[model samples]
Target: MKSNRFHKQLCAFLVTAACMPQAHADAKKMWVQGSWVNIRQSADMNAKVIDHLSTNTPVFLIAQKDKSCEISWGISGHGYIPCKFLADQVLVFADVATENSSPEKAKNYSPTRAFWIAPSMRGLFNAGKYFQENLLKPEQLNLENGSVQDRPEPQRPPKLIRYSVPEFEAMKEMMNKGVIAPVVAFAPLFSCEQMQEAKRRQVGSSKDEFTRSSNDWSAPDAEKYPYSYIYAHDCLVPEIPKLSLPKIKVSYFKDVQKVLPGNTQIEEISAKFGIVERGSVTGSPRWALDYDTYRYTGAWDIGSYTLTLDKPVYEHVIGRTGLVAVYRWLPGIDEEPFGPSASCEEGLRNQRNGKELLSGYPKVKDALLWFQSATPLSFRTAKINSRAYLAPARSLKEGEEQRGIKKVVVYEVDLDGDGIADFVQWDMWGEPEISGPSPLLTLRQIFININGVWHPFERDSYGECT
Candidate 1:
């Protein structure tokens, strides 16, 4: 009889437990009221703004009887909103403490809870203070990079010169056609002697044109002859006549007759000029120029002189050490002299220590001037590519630990749509070696397109690839 009574009580208890409301299923609902509210599933997604709440506008919240209450809006056949969106809403529910006092007392009742605010309300509230702090006040918005005071002064446009009749006509024609054309002409200057010669020759047939003497030439005057004269129609200008100067011939041969003042044998003549005596004729001879005594001789008079020398002249003149030294050091050959001997000496000095000699020689200084002329310099940029492992989805139940990435092989990426590969970054691994409660790694990969290729964006010195 006692066993049957215990069995009946156990059956009754099981029935009561089965019919009791689940803690999670028991949740409360609430309505939203405001000037404007934006309904959205999550914070990141766009919100639907509701301007006014009416009888049909149904918005509510429900709190789970268990830990972490779940909230939603609308009714069946309607979409569910995220619980976090109605964090500010109130919760309502019937008291269930009277029905399951013994069981509730025996079970632990610590509850986990979460809340949400309408996305539109959150954005406005958060943005309101920020806008007021940053935008409403002018003083707070003023930026100081030192650029306001350091700006460069404005530049004035260049002045244009007035054009003459013919010049104006040419410029006008070019301007009408939308083309740029430069005008260039020669302004001939002459000296007095040249002008006189031109007049004597009666070279210019037209009264408007006459050749001026070469001596009459002067520095061009910008105020007077501002530009070269241009002609229009069938006008013609006379050609300038080239002036010719009298030709003079200077000989460097031994003047034997002048030196000796009498007839002398070939042996005596050779000895007098330091001429190397071969069997019958002298092979090489040394001679000096007496610049003071030398006079200009016309070209036609060169072959008239007959040279003769005496034995005494040979002993006294050719044996001089200075003449022998000069002939040995600077022997005249058939080839033309490059320039004055002084120029050759200067070139040698420049090759030795040019910087030290720059001040002494103005010509050398000008040649070595190091001015910074505007020229384009070449530069290069490097490109790179990389790959990243994505984060796994979070789950409620614990299982086998997720497998971490083994190796990351980064290849060059052509992010700019260019086919060429620029650079590569490889051997990447996640940070924070061990994984358990805390995340193993917070990984992020950045890429920058430079010179038409994607490069790994690095923060330190290694990032600079130029």
Candidate 2:
């Protein structure tokens, strides 16, 4: 009787073991679609996101539900992934253990840790040049030094292979699922300016770091430079246009060499971009990009770039270089006649929008630091750190309670002389209560027109906006 009981238990164990492989087979490999998709505790979109996976991340499917699917890394690592953000590809994670790890295993890998890259096709071309000069051939055919005679003429390395059809298909496969971004080669020191330029060219709607690439195809092919990563993914998409604003080209200025000649000349200040005098803290003058280069923005300031319309039709004081220096926007151009005086509520509004509330100096300077880091991040939407109070348009009536925000400046200026105004400097205001003793001059938000839609940017809204 005891032997029969043991036999029955052994048969049950054998049946259970046989079913395990079939259960594992039910898990189909899947890819995350958007730049990021929340890993939810349950299948509901509204359910709490346990975590977020980047574009091109791979997961194993456990089972399917109506709007979502149960994804499994291992036994305990199971959660509902939304079906809408999922793609058809089945990219799998290779676990050394052979036994599938749990969802908790996902935390062990961060696909985006070194994700911020700075490779342009041009940059790649430049890097290859660098590799040739520095690593491949340390000594060059210098007529002066005879360094070329030092070693057997270094065999010119074969030209880098163009991305193969397989690589291109890999790209299309990844792109079909999520946002595709420029894959930057990891550099010991990355350039913030270059990454910022790339950000302007990347595809996305947000302006913050990581957030900008939130929709881009997450490059899983990050390796040492000149590897398959270069030109393999979306890094070489020719459709990406050089970012520029529609400032009906009034004139282009020459880069200034010295402290702009003391002559406050009109022609010097007319261009949409120019080099200006920025004195060091010790009061020594040095040339720098225009202090207010990107101050005047429009609604069209989305994607990887913020195009501008600097050609505003000036009714009065239209050509005041000093005024332009003070308010970067033209609404502040006709502040006195077009709007109000400093003592009045309108004046405070313009001031808030002008440099008073949002100083462009620190914001622009601080951003460079981010790019210099080993992992430089770009943004679609970012915080500038300048304090701003965003609220609806309402008048400060007599005997009415005053909200935290008071007195704003909002007006349209034809920044590019296009007859149709394309830029707006709005909500520049002063709230003595929060602004403290000084009257805060800041716009509620600055809008620039792109195509037809107006995109808005506020102080502390985009990267390092102080």
User: Candidate 1: how many backbone clashes?
Assistant: 26
Question: Candidate 2 on 97-181: residue-level lDDT in tens?
Answer: 1122356654433222112121122222222222223333333313211221212343222222112232122222222222212
* CA displacement after TM-score superposition, residue 391 of candidate 1 (Å): 83
| Strongest candidate by lDDT | 2
How would you encode candidate 1's per-residue C-alpha lDDT over 1-466 as one tens digit per residue?
Answer: 3333222222211235432223323454433322123333333334442221211123334433222223433222122343333434432111110122246532421110000111111111222222323332353223210122212443232221111232112212222222111011112222223333444444444454343222232232211221222111111112212211112122211122223211223333333333322221112111111222211111111111122211112111111111110001111112111111212221011111112221121222212101010111111111233354333433435674544332343444322233444222233333334323433322222222233323223211111111
lDDT of 1: 0.24
Cα deviation at 160, candidate 2, in Å, is 40
Q: What does the lDDT read for residue 431 in candidate 1?
A: 34
What is the TM-score of each predicted model, taking all chains together? 0.12, 0.23
